[model samples]
Target: MYIIFIGTGWFSYVFSLVNLDIYFSKNHWDRYTNFAELSLHILCAIGIYIGRFLRFNSWSLVTQPKHFLSILPGELIGKFPLVVIVLTIAIIAGLYALCKPLVAKSSLYRE
Candidate 1:
């Protein structure tokens, strides 16, 4: 589990770098984005450590209770698209990782 999280975090970091290079070729690199990416990687690493030491499932979707009732509907509406994109990317990446070993084995057998 720790290995998986580290691998995923490293993969995500590399992917983000590639994306930044392609999309921000003409513009200066945004420090906030860099920080956010690094922080996320660290968070995953920490989560893996916690899971290993505390025997918790690190991949579980743990949500925090928020005061959504007090928040304006407009803010939630604006965040919907961003949430969708994040979830989509996460799902795609997870699927890719899950399939990678089988794909590699199949290619090796074919060759």
Candidate 2:
């Protein structure tokens, strides 16, 4: 959790230092940065989903908020199919993995 916060903080700090909008507009280095940023955001989303399901509470909120905003601009690139599919898969997998620990001791049938 602490590690996730540190990583997210570092990623945001580095992202703030660059002119990503302008870079994309000029077609200079945007492809690499966009892919990297997308990958990172997807991972963060998965992390947040897992944390929430497991009630981890640490660094989940910090990382989760960015997921909504990041996906908006992502649509502009017309790189939809792959990124969306990957993110969906990641989220589903995270939820499934987290659910086991969370639901393992819970009763499925009401007695």
State candidate 2's TM-score: 0.29
Candidate 1 residue lDDT tens string, 1-111: 999997766655555544544454446655455554445544554444435433446334343214322332333354553455455456545654565445435533222
RMSD (Cα, Å) of model 1: 13.6
Q: What are the RMSD figures for all models against the true structure? A: 13.6, 19.2
Q: What lDDT would each prediction earn against the true structure?
A: 0.48, 0.50
Q: Mind giving the per-residue lDDT tens digits that candidate 2 earns over 3-97?
A: 99976674443343233434664777665765654555566665554444334455545776576446534543454545555666565445544
C-alpha lDDT (0 to 100) for residue 24 of candidate 2: 60
Cα deviation in Å at residue 56, candidate 1? 0.9
Score every model by TM-score. Answer: 0.33, 0.29
Candidate 2 lDDT: 0.50
Maximum-lDDT candidate: 2
For candidate 1, the per-residue lDDT at 47 reads 49
Q: Where is model 1 more than 4 Å wrong at Cα?
A: 1-13, 20-29, 59-111
